[model samples]
Target chain A: MLVYIYDGSFPGLLTAIYESYYRREKPEEILAQDQWQHTLFAQEVVIKTDEKKADKVYQAIKDKISGFAARNAYCVFLAEVPGAEMLIYNYLSRGWKLGAKLDFHLADEAVLQVHTVAKKVRQEAHRMLGLVRFRLLKHELYYAQIEPDHNILQMISPHFARRMADQNWIIHDVKRGLAAVYNQVEWVLTPLERPKTISLDETGLFYESLWQKYFSSIAIKSRKNLRLQRSFLPKRYWKHLVEMDESRSRFAESSVLSPQSPVKTYK
Target chain B: MELLEKLEILANAAKYDVSCSSSGSTRKNKAGGLGNSYASGICHSWSEDGRCISLLKILLTNYCIYNCAYCVNRSSNDIPRAYFTPDEVAKLTVNFYRRNYIEGLFLSSAVITSPNHTMELLTETVRKLRNIHNFNGYIHLKAIPGADLELIKEAGSLVDRMSVNIELPSASGLKLLAPQKKQDLIIRPMDYIKLQIYEHKEERKISRKVSHFVPAGQTTQLIVGATPDTDLNILQLSEKIYKNYELKRVYYSAYVPVSEHPKLPQISQPPLLREHRLYQADWLLRFYGFRAEELLNESQPNFDLELDPKTNWALRNLHLFPVEINRADYETLLRVPGIGVKSAQRIIRARQVRAVTFDNLKKFGVVMKRAQFFITCRGKYGGQISLENKLLRQYLIAKPKPIQHSSPYEQLSLFNESVPSIPSEVMLSNLTGEL
Candidate 1:
């Protein structure tokens, strides 16, 4: 059984898909470079990232299937799940046979997995539209910091750019060390390193206090439910929230974090 | 007072209101403006009670002339009273919106001195937000009862959504709990807003830009459990209003006991479960095409605390069950237990290509555990055993221990309460997505 491996990049995975079709042999599994799990009796095939080869596979999917289906395949690849490379390969192979009608085969696991993973990315992107809280930096830039589980920076940035069109803002994906910067008129994505410190200007600091006051005041006193609060905004997100201060998180739970409870709290 | 202090008092005064949705408006961002609105409202944060805080929901002032027993801002209550100037409110909305702290302003107020005086200030705040600040975000304004119709129309013109809250479900409750408020005073504005919305639609056909008059339409609220109104009475009233007013939504706020009144029940907390059940039943009325009389009669007045309203209805009407999956129409499939709007649509879409089985239906979003007893997959039955109606209810309604899987120590705290297993198929009629 052959196991295909590629660099942990979406185009790299697409190149691997092109190789499987070129070889006329289906790989048993496809894993990322760092994601090898030591499969017994598996012949490993390392595929390099070639832009031309990846473009060939990309054009085939886009030309054969509708653009919507092609975009769905790309998003599914971005989900970055362990065996997503092989899942896309299976989906594309089926798509080439049936064109745009391939997505209608929801009963097929390969098709369903593509839908599920793309949905996960889209859902997270929608959630980030609300979860992002911009801070007023001393230099008068509206900045927000997010450490999302998925690489949803591009997905969520367009929304902010449209909404805050006149304001110069930067949305930093702290986990991936990338940023989506909007300079009043247009927006662009660039690589960013984690900043050493983030200082809130006096106006930003004042509004944060007012917002915290508003947040706490709005909660119905008779219904002090930490469980429901944690369920919606989860613990891992609390560190970034101005109102959900460290004290609130500490008072809500024990030292030991439960897995079922929100996935992340503090770094 | 500082802005923070005022926000605390004003938000405290406005806490009883449960209309937190910033939906139904799809206004896009202007060329040099601040924010826009999505059709499905964005929830920035949820409060401790699991209520979505979509908008910067606060009052313009906590000061009031009328002393309503149920209101925290009643004149005699002597709570810390603060009034935000129209400029302050406009700036506050823009600031919070720019920071992504809120969707927009849910601006309500107590009747200060007079309804006209309070409404004029509220309308001015929104007008300033739009004209002066160039804020194009969503603004949901409350139509003050007994205020001038001209002022109400002006406010409706500026804002996306307008509401006149029928705080008490029944007129008698309004007379007893809120002596100053009359039912006609509230209904008049609602009727006027509805007529204007109808007129605007007709006018928009002639001219595409008819100023988008109350473009998101009107909504109102009913404070449940505050009066002796039964679920039947509440649902009937809601049904009547929905048909008559063409209102966007009817918000149900479970009455949280704020002040002591001789007539009011001294319950410690709001009737959340009942509110939840009513919302579920309301969903049935609006979307599922079930009527109030069908769901509840004199024999069954209140909803069962254990079973949801749809499940309850399905169990009673078991003769309609075991529907053939391949042939069942969309409406019939919807009546089956656990078949929601999304799943029903999925089933219809999937069946267009090929015959569906348990595997296909599962992928199609059907909830099999509840739906199994009701549906058949091409003449094949999945149920291993069939019990009598009584035994089946006992099986379905029994609470599976939530803490058993975690550990024994989970039993020590009641805060680790058993969560309702249902994903709450019920949603607000106006809102598109689940809460």
Candidate 2:
């Protein structure tokens, strides 16, 4: 069994893929070196991150599968799953070999699993579209931050930049310390400093108040269901939700004052 | 008032309209437009009801001259109302779009001043978004009932989709709930939009170069449980809209009991599960080749609440099942309980190569537990011993008790403990390899 290791970056992963195909090694035999713990009897090779090697792999993937599939494969790799390295390598090798006919065969567990992961990532990307709330900062750059479950900041940036082609806005993936900034006409990705807690501006808070008031006013009093609302946009996300403070506060106040049932209220 | 305040007020007011989805359309960026419409589905935010928040689901103004009892923004309601200038709305849309907050704008209103006045403001906003702003993203404008025909046609040219809410199904209900709104006013414009879409289609077929109009098509929403209308009436209305108007969708919003109006039903909560069931039924009618007459007739008004519409229909007609998987036609396969459109397609496609067995069906991601009873594998039966196994049917639908094997819960706990060592995005992305 040949075990392959890389620097645990996207380019590094691509390079490893290049090597696996180059050496004609089965993907199952390949193991990420960081994950490899001295397998008693296997040939191991460390794949250096090379742009040329990555490009070669990318070209090969595009040639075999659609560019869409290749990009999806890269996105799957970005997920950073434990067995993802081997799984993707296997999926690519097998998928390419099978050709376009591979889509007809969802029978393969590896193909099905990878497809499911891709779908989940896509679903999260879509959900973030609705859940993401922006805060206007002091710089006039409409700023917002998100701690997404997936690396979706890049996936979501182009849509915003094209639609908002006259204003500057920055969407910082605070958890990843990566940001996508659009300056009216174009957008680019940038890395932020060791991310600390960002202070909410007064206008941000004011918007929060207004938004909260708006949300409360629209919610049907007779149909208010906190449990269900919390299920989708979990309470943990409420702190960032502009319209959520008053509801949570109201709940707290009611619990303190009346305790049981607490009398559900909405405007 | 400043533009921001107006935006907040109007956007907030407009939030109640439910058809803001950016899905079901495939408009790409044209010569001058900014963003493109995604056919694969976009703008997937959900309200508290877990409904999709696709477009900027907001109104131009909550201030109204009409007093619809079901609507919170009715003019008579002593609520803090606001209105947005055409520029303010355009700016908010640009900002929201720039931030990736909304697909475009879902600009609805409460008949501010009059229908014509509200319609004029809306048409102006959409025109600016399309021509002045050169924004081509998806714009779903609410066509105000009783608005001028010329204004409606002009607005339709600038937007991707348009809707005129049939808040109530019948004329009597409309009169009872919303005294100001007339059936003719809403239906007439819908008739006009339908004719326009038809004419546009015919023109495209011949000319092949005329710019597409209402590319996303038209859709309407019916506030269910608000009036004493049954599922049959609602489905019938939806069917008519789909057939006559060529509407893209008929959204059924389970009426949230908000106000204590004399004409309204004194219910505690909206029939959410029922609304969900309607969506399922609607999907079946649209995609699965099922008809309204087949699912619900004059006798059976409401859908079965316990079992889903498909499952209920399948149960009521059981002799149709146990059809041969490899040989049964697409329609026959679709009729089988627990078999969806995707699953049926999978069966058809996979069976072309080899005869699909029980094992093969499972491999194709079929829910075998539910399907096991209804299918025979290569003339072999593994279903209930007796054809009339009522207890078995109950068991099939019964909830399963907790049983831990590989223990995904434990795995998740371990994952949570280790997450602090690495970034959550990378960690989640790596696990599923999705992002």
DockQ list for all candidates? 0.53, 0.17
Q: lDDT for every model?
A: 0.83, 0.72
The prediction achieving the highest DockQ against the true structure is 1
Q: Model 2: what TM-score for its first chain?
A: 0.80
Q: List TM-scores of chain B, every candidate.
A: 0.90, 0.88
lDDT at residue B324 of model 1 (Cα atoms): 88
**Tens-digit lDDT track of model 2 for B17-122:** 6675666566666553566677645643335544444566677777788888998787788877777778877866765554454577787888877789889999
lDDT of residue A12 for candidate 2: 86
Q: At residue B257, what lDDT does model 1 achieve?
A: 88
lDDT of 1 at B254: 86
- Model 1 lDDT, residue A101, Cα: 72
Q: Each model's fnat?
A: 0.73, 0.29
Docking verdict class for candidate 2: incorrect
Candidate 1: which stretches are off by over 4 Å?
Answer: A5-7, A31-56, A247-267, B359-364, B401-435
* Interface RMSD per candidate (angstroms): 1.4, 4.2
